[model samples]
Target: MSLGDEPGYGDAPRGEDGGYGGTGQTRTRLPDRAGDVYGGARRGRSSSRSLVTVVGVVVLLIAAIAFANRGDDESAPGTGDSDKTKTAPTAASGEQPVQSTAGGIPAGFAHTGQGAQSAAANYAVALGSAEMFNKSKRDAILTAVIIPSRVAEFESSLDKAYTPGFNKNVGLNEDGSTPQGYTFVSRTTPIGTKLTSSSADHATVEVWCSGLLGLAGDNSTNPVTNGWFTITMKLEWTSGDWKIVTHSQKDGPTPVPGDDRASSADDMAKAVEEYGGFTYAR
Candidate 1:
């Protein structure tokens, strides 16, 4: 399958200061063939290997589901005077907002449920970002947003996923570079966030997001296209901040595609270059 063909795969926005942004730029039109944009020429992988890869991904997802349900019995909602009331998830927090960052990624989230939601939303943007395709920036993002224990694992997984062939498939060079004259667009916009569960030390949050991916240029095979997905992150309060422990995504609660005229490659490229992404707050 092409990168765009991957069921839950999505992209994040490039920020003004070369960081990942919270909101993805809106695409006014749909591509004629979204799959052609990301999954065009195949890099020669054998059918057998491709089948193995698919099986591996399925196994991993099954394991993730089992892990997510592991503590369900023990984590039932509490109802007693001694138990603290679980705050309902909201789109924004009325409390003072977090204002600090590490490596340009949001940091210093409060210990409240709202803070966990914010962290999840921002982390979703970071994970889906174009920066994740670059080795150095990808490492920095992993260190900044993920818990120390899982940083190495996340880095390795991403490195494997964004291989040279995959880079080429996305219209990037082997080293994750944009070819001259072409603009690479990969951005994710979070619609909202929800706190599935939270505690003083641990939290689970889900971010609903839409993204733009592909390349734009004259005669470019892959024109910018949009996608929707939901990212679920498990967070832990550590080192005075909320850090990601685990994350998984699923195909979205997407709406019907609208009837809008697709923009030209030049127009899409110009829009990406001129527009800047936002720093998300919840």
Candidate 2:
């Protein structure tokens, strides 16, 4: 790679000064990928990746080491007392309005409020999914969840991340293959969702989620990865439903974990392969 060359990683997060941050920038005079001075960054990514994996595995272990801790009741389905208090719709016509659609994914949802929150929660699940790392599978995900207009952009951007070298770097087979005996698990559980603001045709939704990522196998570079973050989605109303338009992420309102016995990688992988995801509502 050229010293001044910046390898694009899709839409790199814009820094506070309105320029993209990270080792990928060329104007910043950052150390090159192969430079000894930049070695620390490579180490940091490796360490952070490993930490995410350990955290994911440790969460399972914690289930067995139960102890009392006080926190908000987050497992509930809806946003708040008012939402939980609403009755479920009995018919399709009774469903809420459309906000936005890219290809088929929900985008720019109605500012009706609830739909945006719902979209954020759902989108976080889709983006954090194991399938998002595979092109064909990711296409299926985009078809199932993304808004119609933005589908092409999402596909094009993510294709770079799921490149053959990227797959190999993440410990998957070069063809994005999962090892026969190994189970690859990735999932996101929404802790809660809230509507930050809304209008008749647009709304901003925020979802606090916990995610897990990793492959199950001995000597795996990509063990399970875990992280807690809040995803904010901007939605619009279109046709007769809500849809997602823009999305962003931040660290979290993370909580301390309790002690628990962690499960073996094999068991975690097996459970992931056997279990399926659900369409979340809030």
Q: Pick the candidate with the highest lDDT.
A: 1
Tens digits of per-residue lDDT for model 1, 95-206: 5547877898888988887788888888888878888888999999999999999999988898899999999988889889999999999989899988888888999999
lDDT for 56 (candidate 1): 100
Worst 10 residues of 1 by lDDT: 1-10
Residues 180-230, candidate 2, lDDT per residue (tens digit)?
767677789888887788887878878888888778777776787677999
For all predicted structures, in order, the TM-scores are: 0.67, 0.59
Tell me how many residue pairs clash in candidate 2: 44
Any residue pairs clashing in model 1, and if so which?
Answer: 12-128, 12-187, 12-188, 13-187, 13-188
lDDT of model 2, residue 43:
28
Q: Give candidate 2's TM-score.
A: 0.59
Error of 2 at 247 (Å): 1.7
